[model samples]
Target: MRDTMKPCQHTLSDDVVYKDVVVVGNGPSGMVTSFVLAGNVPYLKDIPEDLPIDEMLRARLSNLPPGQSLYDADLLELAEGLEGRSQNPISLLMDNLLRPCADLGIQADSLIEWRYDVEKEIDHVVLGRGPPGGAWHTFPPQVRTLSPGAWLSLPPHTTDSAERLTASAVAEYCRRYVQACHLQRYFRCNVVVTSVTAAPPGTGAPCSPACPRSASYCVSGYDHKEGRGFRYACRRVVIAAGACDRPNVLPEHISHHALHQLAALEKAAQLNQQHPKSQSRCWWWVRGVSAADAVRLARASGLHVYHLHRTAADSLAKLPLLNYPDYNQVYKMMCDGASGNYTNYKSLPEHMIVEVTPLLSPQTTNTEEENKIRLKKVKLLNLVTNKTVELTVYIVAVLIGSKPDLFFLQTNFDLNTIEIKKCKCNEKKIDEKQCFLRNHWHYLKSVLGQSIQSCKSRYLNYTEINGNIDTKCALPDCNKRDTCTCNTKAERGLAVRECKCEIIPYSNLRREKNCQCQPTNPYSSGLGYGIDPKKPVDGRSNPVAIDKSTHEMFNFPGMYALGPLTADNFIRFIPGGALALVTHIHREMKSE
Candidate 1:
């Protein structure tokens, strides 16, 4: 069929060729959509002049593979070939093709760049300027697939026996999949979609008389090769732009002053290096900071910090500890240097400026003396205890977590329809005083309160320990208590005069047979302490709402989305979602 049909001349040129579909991404989702549409629909082989494009594209979609059972023997074969070899099936194929040369000690990496030239075979164009792998190409080399290698596989291609895959492998696999399936011919690489606007009235090819002036959509973008803008009018548009394409910015509520203060503290710390013996003391008040950011900033500043909220546990786990060596070092530093003491600060001074009161005359005080005197103490009120503790430190660093990166969505779409709202933790209205704190502090405080209550209950139970009961001894000063007895007879005689109970470490006491009270895991919660119990921590937020049946934008007809854009960013869910979306588009186009 491909050999018999001549390629559209307009597509070859810079001129606009009205297509049945124009997929606006080259990611897994975009590639799958193009493949499914081209492979299934036979009318794409020859667009009838009299028939409407949508109707022509959708015709006989039923004859194609069933949506639910799209995976078949051909796909299985591809999977088998790809299994246990390489993440990039194309790379694997190339390796196989060049194996004879490799046996003669030829270097494949030196022979060619690991990229395939895609042919523009299908009527529909898959537009992306990025590497054939899309967002996967930008992923860190050390990053591994959250889902198994098989889950990362696109349709008609499988990862085979491989259980896991790295980011590079996934990228290569995508490139290879495109080449192997001959889907590359459909791709228009090096074209970035700038905007998707409604087709201008009374322009382009007419699909029907009822909407003679209207085309469903016109995708306009810059072509890097041509160094000029290009537009394509299409009956359907699929937006497979991954979630991370546009970086999310921190929320407006976050205090710039606090960040400036942190920067100043960092500068001050750097200056204190000259006097190693008299190192300035730094205390990080981790109230609003995300666990990930806290660790990062703390490591950068060389400051001792602590997480005061259990909510940070989830964010902490999402940090790429394994992929980035710095994260591992920071994790170790946080564990060793900082205390994970969750404390509530209530009814405190809003902003107390503590500057060292100069004792010596201005003329007598030298620069070194002035620097020493500049380090002063700050008072913090403990909400639980209602006591003000003066912490003698040069600077206090406050870490507040970052907000979702929905800048692109907010700018492009309606926020209300998309359901972009303040975080669940950001319940209270921000005030001038509270602006310095994190939005999620209240939520973290509540979790801390629960932990504290649990700890108190354990402490109370320990104090009530009896001789008959297998109780953890809660005697605060067991050494001070002369009434304590030991199990050994040798220490029994000394029990009346001195406390004979062996002093076991607090952590070890939990598992000790004689210890009555067991301490709870300090970081225990739904997400666990210091790690993301959930695989993808950023789920449920910054979602691009889509109709499940069609995977289309609820408000925008002819516009579809998938992958992280639709709240299903995991590797496992992307392929299925891509399939369903394409199927829906096919059915919808067919109905037209």
Candidate 2:
């Protein structure tokens, strides 16, 4: 007799408010956005038929100046032509909810404070440190107006509004706490982070020192009134907080490799000249391939070679290339980039890893016969044992690294040895499991590292990243760390350990995880290897989540205003036949 399982227990609706707009970040963008939207809101429709009489009364009452009253204010409304709309229709009904509420009162004051310090420096020195005669603002502190002079001068996306989504359980002392007391009077609400780890350029922080909206904000945790923080809702949330608004930093050891890659990129860029998007045609995708393979591929006609993790995919995603990285379409051999002779981030055996050397060439350019051939790897020195270890070069290389979660090793274990686990494609000949583990592990450390398993487990956060792997993933449950599902045994010849939550190998990544603390993978959702990896995960659901799938801003309307259009990006970037190819591919996919 089969036992019946219980019915699905439904949950209650959270106390969460369905905001008309819940802007994630509270940086210059969020704040000024809220201010412009709320305080000086423009009317949605033209003049609202009722305005003429109101204007007339105000004009009659104010003989001296129509500007003195509300009617004198310039009417604000949607421009005659709003831009950046897609084929799919979206809501004409968006609720006007104010994000980053008024806890930012001192935010205005701190900006004023910082500005005063600079202006007074030269004058104070001229006076020999004597008390200044007057202050910078021509009027008294009480005079609040959006006139020629005001605190709302900074552009959005640059300064910190200081208010942010405080994840539950983890109290945020960085901004909210700073905004609490006397500190607000002296300092800005949210502090901006200026380093690569915190806020990178094109983020909340501008690279230029003299950027109109340049300033650092604070980031840290503190005690709250106990509980009460982030509430997980069914709808979507955003993460456009600020540059200083990052989750965590990578460990010092892992981060240096990215810096090395950046240095190489700089040199490469210099060698190719600034307009090298053309000559820099070598599409090197370093994932789980060997150095021999890398050299082989690099020497090939089209593609270049590099290692995963070392390439810095996620971090660089925040840069200009994410918009249209010509590298994406180049034949990419997807693999984890880990020198797994001995380390973590190893890909499993059962998972499909197609091996073949990939073809690479100047993207979007017609290739000549001379530019289309593959290369083979030559024997390389095995320094560890001084033996020759040969590696083969194949199409598109991927780095394979391992990230062993205690969550896995802790819960499901019956092992005493450092055994390599593998899935049997057939289980007829090769000792794939033991062979793989023995080839790429430090038995001593795996055993030794278990000394500290007593630490309390907080929560888990697995943010699903984007395909480009440039920007940070949206926080899953901000308060929690990342906890992934790891299967203990290989059931039916399939290794259950392999999942997106596992190690993410990328040609480039600013970071794979956020919190460096153990027992939890900080940025666990692993860098988005490609667009919505879930499509690869689940059989159903389209990979591309049409605009309606998300509540966040898709693209900027005035992108054309920022930079001049180049033929490479504006038109030629797409492979000549990609559009037709994409259509055909989509049709095939739908049929399948």
Candidate 3:
């Protein structure tokens, strides 16, 4: 028993390594914190005497010249050629650092020991499997930052140009920053942190005599590639795993029996395809679906699509109409398809789906079987008609939109820690939900108005300046003051067409008399889009609340949360927030 105990103790001691800080995520917040600590923090800049030399030597060689060595030069040349075409951050960093080295004649062989000491500056560990740039890695190629390019600059690293950057470019920039600073060795990618607990009282003591404060946490995680569990004893832990790490799937108030009928309809469609002469018909009732997806679905199903939208005009102007050729095709398709079956509702429906208050027959009880039977022929209330119309719908596709991934927070943290409660009625009579809805409706109205304004400007330019008038605008002479009048007049030897343009008043579209929710700051308000009701009113909720000044968790000492994990969701704010936290951490360490 004594021999076995000794072996277990030895194994446990060998498994755990001590560090000054442990960042639990590899996203923007974690990467920036790690970068700052490694590069700027004075106390953490201690190089251990027994630090690994081989890893440092390899890192330095990748960023230095081969000098007169043929073998090294060839290897470096090959690496540079491959790296030029590579999007990998490390590769880009190596290229950036090494390009100047060859011209300067800085040899790799002579800098082995010097690089080793430089690599050992910071004693921190970043644990996560996410790409080096964190959530930016998952961003679509065309996804642009809300702020201008200059606002996204991290300390000691600036963007290539002072223009708005796409997600891919921003992510690459983050990678380059990491590589340029030589902070790659500190990252433990593919490491998933399972649990973080307070270290045992005595075990919390500093691993090194020089460390002012004792270690506070024992972080345990599993490595994907290694297929083994690892542990770390660290003085501080930063939780920057990101708020959207988990998906927030709200509770479905409706029963599954209604949704199941959709599947039955799909099966019937498949079987109908086998028999062409069948009189059976399948129609799609699309509501709140994107124009692109709706067209694709309609084309694929070959069904008469009834597109119900809450707008006066059918326009793809508000949608994400980027420069992609496929998107352009989709826009054209949507415009052509709208004339066939699009119903632009002046006002939103009271309820998308109406429940059958009582069973169809008096004999039927509210049983599951009876409910399914009743739901088959449910009544849909028409907001315009103020009447209920009964229909036998084979399937219903509900595509509202997506919410933040908050599943991780839900499973790990308590409800109050992450749950955002619905707004309460106050004496001021402000309906929070209604306020959000009105703001969104107004924003959409503004976008539509802008589109119409652009069209009017082009029409004026063609008629007055170019002397070319649209055939649609060429009409018989009418009174100049008439609202429906369209007449062509000569101006400076050019044909000038005068037409009364009728545009929907933005005020009429907005329901709320007064909108208290105005954008005081672009950084805090986010994009003018309406906030999802399922999300916290403030935005995404973090698992741990932290001090704004220190970025340290309120409940747990030496623990911090940053980036999207906090209130700020924009990329522009991340660098500044991270810098503050890093600065606070350094100050605390220095004081101790």
Candidate 4:
């Protein structure tokens, strides 16, 4: 083995900076994580009646002091003891505290009390492409969040209003959050991370005197503002950069008039102001829920939209109607077709454009102006009818979805070659039967989307297909996909017994091994986290397998995946991922 201490192996950048922890992305997740690491700790304030929390969790908290400060150990213990929704306990706990029983229509006070403790502070730096709001800064000001304003708030600095917040408002709130929490000094905007690799042993000073295990990772990137390359060797690194940076692009080449996001739509609207008001129509090919916002933007800009989607109206059922009113309204417009009050919209279900060709029509003498405006004919393929149709429009916007840019991790290392070991049980295993019995509830909850309150009952929430409950089977004799139907009264008891799918533990999920750990995040793309080096990274691929208790990757020791990368896409739940990460690091430093 090469000596890691001797500076003879590989050249270290001369301007390399060292820190205890380096967080990627200064978005909501990044901001929340930085705030916790900056010494803000949450304590138990007061538990309310019927909060829908795990019974064991309630018992554990009841024993603690009225204003007891929850350290890493306390949090880890509570998370481990939690039942029913333990896939990401820290996130679940945080969501419950921040918005207590929101689904049940119970307006309860927060049970958490936050206090600043300089002793718990960790040395860290947050790096992002833009300011604190991440992708929100890039969205059009008119676009609003699906959830209410309170859902977008960072903990310890929350909002009481229930109205939906605009993109600009959310961005401003994120910037103000950093300043309010005194975390501005740790955030570095306009920096793009290029690579993150294991540092040479004894390459630089450790995070602290005792925690020598950290500061073993080397991060390299480019500083956009400074116009120079930068390097950092930190004890630990957190990937919170989020999934919206890279939009999923179609394979077919099209004209420059194509728009992927609402921001681009806004830009296109400004440039086309010279066009006649009567000739206002845009062609859109959309897939995921994100496209709903784009449709709103197009209509708001006085453009009639011709929306095309691959699937039928059933796919829209995945969105929660109560929380996502805007999405629900969009779904209603699609279902009702292009008539009545929704005359400005046109829905083309089960159809996709196969080809886009620019039409050669009459042009003006001004070359620049003529190039800016043109007509394109799109060939659409109806999947059900096997027919092709063509339509002409000024703009073609394809809004499928997006994923986090995990290219840094992939390009730096071939993850497939890494060896993985089976996770050890916390206590001595007596027998396989007993172990299964003890962990059966957790396994069931993980498969059913991790929350008893959020699980959709078969009788109440199942989509009807041809007048029958959707079994996800085409033929009459075919076996149904593991989904079971249960009445509301028997939901808990029947689901536990009938939902007998494989109970793979979170620690066993390995990207290199290509294990299919279904996405626990409700809004996830339903794509497995495994990374196939040969394939392109979509909006959901390359998610690191993390230990929920600590938010640390199983294969990589000092690395953590936070926010949407961990399946906690919603802002309300990201703070918990942050707490898990900070608490784990704080505990390690204290132990050393």
Clashes of each: 17, 57, 5, 5
| Per-residue lDDT over 1-592 for candidate 4, one digit per residue giving the tens place of the 0 to 100 score | 0111222233345677777789988898888888888888888777766567667777877888665566633666666544323247888777777777665555666777888877777778999989888988998887777667766778786556677888899889888888888888999999877666676577455443434333577777778979886878887899887878656566526434466676776777766665675346564657556677777766776777888886534546666777677777878777665352675678887787788777766466745334534677888899888999998887788776666655455222232222222221121223455446535756765543222222222112212211111222111111223332221112211222122233334231221111111111111221123343323333244454688788897667888887777666678888888888887877676656
lDDT of each: 0.43, 0.22, 0.44, 0.63
Worst 10 residues of 3 by lDDT: 517-526
Question: Tens digits of per-residue lDDT for model 3 on 195-258?
Answer: 5666656534433323423557777766889888687877777777764432221123333333
Model 2 residue 49 CA deviation (Å) reads: 15
Per-residue lDDT of model 1, residues 423-490, tens digit only: 11111222443433434555754644322333333334221111112223333422232344422111
Span of ten consecutive residues with least summed lDDT in model 2:
121-130
* TM-score on alpha carbons, each prediction: 0.45, 0.23, 0.45, 0.72
User: Highest TM-score, which number?
Assistant: 4
RMSD of every candidate to native, in Å, equals 23.3, 23.6, 22.7, 17.8
Misplaced by over 4 Å in model 2 are 1-34, 45-238, 241-264, 271-592
Residue-level error in angstroms, candidate 4, position 294: 2.1
- TM-score, structure 3 vs. true: 0.45
Candidate 4's C-alpha runs over 4 A off are 1-14, 48-54, 65-68, 72-77, 80-87, 201-214, 254-257, 277-281, 312-326, 338-342, 360-373, 410-542
Clashing pairs in 4: 214-235, 215-234, 215-235, 402-539, 403-539
